[model samples]
Target: MHPSTPGSTDQHVLHSAAQWLSAGSPVWLATVVATYGSSPRPVGSLLAWSADFGMAGSLSGGCVEEDLIARLRAGQVDGGQPQLLLFGDNAAEQARYRLPCGGHLQILLQRLGKDDLAGIQQMLAWLSSRTPFVREVSLHASGQRLTLLQHDSPQTCRLTSEYFIQPFQPAYQLLIVGAGEVARHLAALAQPAGFAVTICDHREEFLQGFDAPGAELRCAMPDTLISQRFADSHSAIVALAHDPRLDDMAMLDAFDTRAFYIGAMGSLATSAKRRERLTGLGVSSTQLQRLHAPIGLDIGSKTPYEIALSVLAHLLAERPQRS
Candidate 1:
């Protein structure tokens, strides 16, 4: 049975699908085009399924994948047409699939041919470059098109009686400016939460042998890193170094970027002092308002892991369409 992980991004599934197609395996693309009530995954969630290669994405948290695969294997689904498959439309189906009470999922299931590999590659290129694009599909039949979206395009999916359109953006990024325990824990937590984590520290000593799986480790100046890259609207910058030398400089560069969350870890008094110092350094009051001093939700966290949890929660709260 193919497993479902709600954590995989759209790039991941598309990437895998492209790989499978290259290796001569036919892949099925399943997308959650619409949802109602208690859906486990969002409307834009994707699942790539191949009889020879299992699955590489998630449409629901549980039984939906197995059921869909069963239908696929039975030859009930064919490559000739794109169709909408609905789950949890009634009480019995909801209970059978263990869907949240009243939850419903409408998925667009399409069989991919080798000719579509180029489109998948293009989608991957767009995601890698942080470009936004839209994939529109006819819900009732085999028709599809891709459109490059404006930089300000809304990051969401829409479903109508005739079509489904989803705007695809790059993965969320988290640049944690520290190599300390809190940064390690946050990186470990953020990866599965779908943030591409980068841990930056200027001190080589702090970076020595530090490990957080899937996190990019950089022993570089944080300020230069922020201003040069990692400052887009999809990025969140958090300074956990606590050292004014490192954290304050990072903050200055962070303010100039379009980063959605700019935060620094500290106690209330420390944060107050930090604000005073920043204001003295010419950080306008308006810019200072965007800084989340004493970063994270007020969860009264004492340990590193707890603090990371609160920080992740706050980040999620600030994120759009988190559900």
Candidate 2:
């Protein structure tokens, strides 16, 4: 897994916690409630620790995990109470946790026992189904108890004096309109970065030769697959077929979806031609603006792998910024 990539670590933590919880183990979940200065992990960052498995995620990018694990082992956080702990707030603490740039992290630790097992399993189900929901944890006035609630609504993650409300967005989905080298490379890079990748192409020969681990390959027309199977708010549709018959149709269909990112790979001249063709096919000028033709950041990429890296970089930059 790419440890520093956004959302990827949270997925890992959730999966690990599910496994441990299924085994009837009491797990402690630590969430980064607030951050001051240049914190390594963002708000809502998670780390799950079980007495048997140690730790499964990261709150800070340094020695903070070690110290937190020590506290858990020493029974400092085992009192069945939700504890709000501060780290790197002072010079000595900063030095001890090795927090870069003197960043400080406020974390909420909640101990989950057998009674919480069903809730954890339900969360895992929601994640597996790519459902959008919010998990709200409110601390009691006595500060010795916390309640977890799940609901569908406007997504948000905020920490107040007595509550922490974290929204869990569905995993980002990437639909590639070709099974070529660029698509394979892109899938390899994107999966580690927390994207659920799907490659759709009608060519049997291309499908036979394509091999990108963890990426689902669909032997169907790009437009058909896109219109029938893909396209959501958290989805990204990329056309890398380099053929108007395929790329144009895919982009046309993608324009109707709520996908945050829609791009097509080509040269500047080729992209202009594609746009003109799309316009001729009844696509509006305003809708055409959403199409990121000549996709990927301008990194002067030449090789297929370099082009893949460029595309991934652009996707990362275009990811929805947390509020």
Candidate 3:
């Protein structure tokens, strides 16, 4: 995950749960049951609790979670039946809790078994596939209670019972064509930002100098190189090599794919020339416009490092705002 954007607490919950299981201990899964007005965590926000590690993730704002953590550490927890935790709004006791925005929230804390961990792993598999998923957990209390929740859905709720959410996508990928200086810099900068970066070039010299950590280096033909790599909405393609034959082939291949960003490196004259060549290759003007020619943002970048920073700034500009 990017330092700028830490991963969702959902992943942390699963991680904590797995940690507890590995250490031969039991863990509890805490999820927001309902929300009123403007709770910090919407319904479905998860917090995993274990005897040893306390809590990972949050069920509500700081106050409620601190209370939950203390309760979790105490060890004699209830089971089989889900409890409702209310904060802020309506109830006098809730107002004492002072949940931000005066909103009310409900939470369900359930002890997790080994089988429950397996189910969480299953959800992670689905998330890796980049497909949306909704899970209905069957909790047998006095009888059997069925609760349905979507990971990454948009629906929110007000009761401590059930709701929906859209799980954040972690598959944003960066395809860097031409393993040159700019490619190296970009690979280094983009990797720490949670982008799965891949650097491609046929030149052995370029590959030899490619030392960016967490980036994949490929010495393959650009046209067919991108075929097996990108598969979803979070994919981006960039051509840092000014070589027309190399960059053009990759750009052409990417144009047919679902990559959200496609950029090429060149000056104004060079970009115009490349455009003419592309038009000659039967690429329409509209298609040609998709190329972010002159690659990075116009930041008056002089060095390769500065240019890479400019490119990354442009890419980050496309990200949605955080809540």
Against the reference, the lDDT scores of all candidates come to: 0.85, 0.81, 0.69
| lDDT (10s digit) by residue, model 1, range 1-323 | 01111234777798999999999998999988777888888777889998898898788876999899999999898678788889999999998888998998988899998988998898888777776687888866764787888766544676778877777655688999989999999998988788889999989999998988899999999878898768787789999998988999999999999898999999999999999999999999999999998999998999999999999999988864533
Clash statistics: count for each candidate = 0, 0, 6
How close to the true structure is residue 33 of candidate 3, measured as C-alpha lDDT? 59
- Encode model 2's per-residue lDDT on 197-255: one tens digit a residue: 99999888889967999899989887767766566677899999987898898998999
Which scores greater on TM-score, model 1 or model 3?
1
lDDT of 3: 0.69
- Judging by lDDT against the true structure, name the best candidate: 1
Candidate 1 vs candidate 3: the lDDT winner is: 1
- TM-score order, best first, reads 1, 2, 3
lDDT of 3 at 47: 81
Listed in order, each prediction's TM-score against the native is: 0.93, 0.90, 0.71
Top candidate, metric TM-score = 1
